[model samples]
Target: MNQDEDAAPVEMLASLCEARGWQYEFVGDDELTTEIQGSWATYQLRAVWRSEDHVLQLICLPDIRVPDDKKAQMYEVLALVNEQLWLGHFDVWSNGMVLLYRHAMMLGDDGLLSVAQAQSAIETAVEECDRFYPAFQFILWGDKSPADALASALVDAAGEA
Candidate 1:
């Protein structure tokens, strides 16, 4: 699609969320916030459209806090988790308590953000957050090392029937 024919990412995302019956709100012309409910936690995701740069940034904040004392160790766990992740990386706010997972996609020259693409991005963020949340819990509450925490979290025991 040509640039003029491209649909705005914000509009596409909003429509996708509405069709899915997900709650979302527009923080600005180019920014939106939505929530995803997971088995472990509810994640708040914010999407920002950068028209000038042709990029969409998705940030996910799970409903958990890293204690101040645990922030250093959390960073270590995040580094290990990020290494294994293909899309997003874990990061802590400067306050050292708020944890976030972030991912970004290039909009390409056409700037056409498809419904499938938006759904995929949202699913990825929610899945990643749910997958790594237990590791962070292990680090903060179980006194597990970064490596051990990640290992435990990543172990998949479910088998095919």
Candidate 2:
């Protein structure tokens, strides 16, 4: 492996974060954490590079809460939401109050996570969270059904006036 590929993935992630001027810190030996500010919300981004498993996991927390009464419908809404996602899926914590987006990929023989891959993972996560944040809000506050919430979220306005 070349020097870049040979470098520990976590170090590379730290480099990437630094180059991008993202505020992040080493949460653990293998984890880097940051926050992504998107149009809809600020998301917590965590990158965990598992050397033993050759896996890189990216998690984005949208920082929304699902109350007990809303959890069931929120899950249903998430089902519909997940179906439309091209990468990663939204999940709730065991406490049923926190919603996070997670996507993981295996490193190839070189065990490298390229900057492009990292960027795409982050962009996808933030975009999806921004796109679907309202749907989650709809279910949480609008009293909309899963289908209705999804529909409300996905509908587009056509006007240039």
Best by TM-score: 1
The TM-score obtained by model 1 is 0.90
C-alpha RMSD between model 1 and the true structure: 3.3
Model 1: pairs clashing at backbone N, Cα or C within 3 Å: none
Candidate 2 segments whose C-alpha is farther than 4 A from its true place: 1-7, 156-161
- Give per-residue CA lDDT, model 1, range 49-83, as digits (tens): 99889999999999678887888789899888889
Report each candidate's C-alpha RMSD, comma-separated, in the order given.
3.3, 3.1
Candidate 2 vs. true structure, TM-score: 0.88
State the lDDT of candidate 2 residue by residue for 1-161, as single tens digits. 33244356677767767777888989889898998788778899898987888998988998998889998999999999999988889999887579999999888867777766766778898888888888999999899999998888877311211
Worst 10 residues of 1 by lDDT: 152-161
At residue 47, what lDDT does model 1 achieve?
A: 93
